[model samples]
Target: MSNIQAMIVNVRVDNLEASLPLYKELAGDVEVMRFPYEDMNLALVGPFLLISGPHEKHISQHATILVESLPLVVDALAKAGAEIVDEPSEVPNGTRLVARHPDGAVFEYLQPRA
Candidate 1:
């Protein structure tokens, strides 16, 4: 079904050190992912993901969906009236595209590098 793989709900926090402990308590023994594009850190705690970084106008809390095929999904989404916010670009371990659906919901789609 649409080749959707995994979904990560990203939460933007003001301080990483302050919030990390709480998340660690909730989801013990988890690994954290660091992003180079921005001063951001991500931790997968249970079914939730915590993304902490400085408060910036361009950075907002959003959900990321991993897909099998980026171009296919992008084309389909565009046909469905989704406004592409960021074009497909290389990230740390994959390519990411940001878009907003017609319902005013924004999401980031990721396709891991092959």
Candidate 2:
């Protein structure tokens, strides 16, 4: 079985503050993990990952998945004929890579920094 840790739904918004309250409420008032990546601002509230910024800077990934091992996930994705949308790179919280599966579903896989 895949060593998937947690999966976060990706949500895009024009204004982070305006959209946060609703997501925060739905997430049971969880603490938010906020960070900046490139030209975008991201926030993690429980299972919801909110991203706000220019639309051009955002990739249409279906979800952000927290994984145990990014390298392992990369190897598995290669064997599964998935296309690497973004190479593994350091983000605020960890390293991440975006991949498009054979069926055309795109996802972001993240491995938190040790």
| Candidate whose lDDT is highest | 2
lDDT of 2 by residue, 4-111 (tens): 999999999989999988988889958999998788888988999889888785579999999999989988998999999899998878999999999999999999
**48 Cα displacement, candidate 2 (Å):** 0.8
Please give, for residues 1-114, the per-residue lDDT of candidate 1 as tens digits. 768988887766677667777877776777755454566676566546677655564535368888999989888897999988888898887999899888888888889888
Count of steric clashes across candidates, in order = 0, 0
Which 10-residue span in candidate 2 carries the lowest summed lDDT? 50-59
TM-score of candidate 1 relative to the true fold: 0.81
Which residues of candidate 1, in runs, are more than 4 Å off?
39-47, 59-61
Residue 81, model 2: Cα distance from true site in angstroms: 0.8
- CA lDDT scores, all candidates in order: 0.76, 0.91
Error of 1 at 10 (Å): 0.9
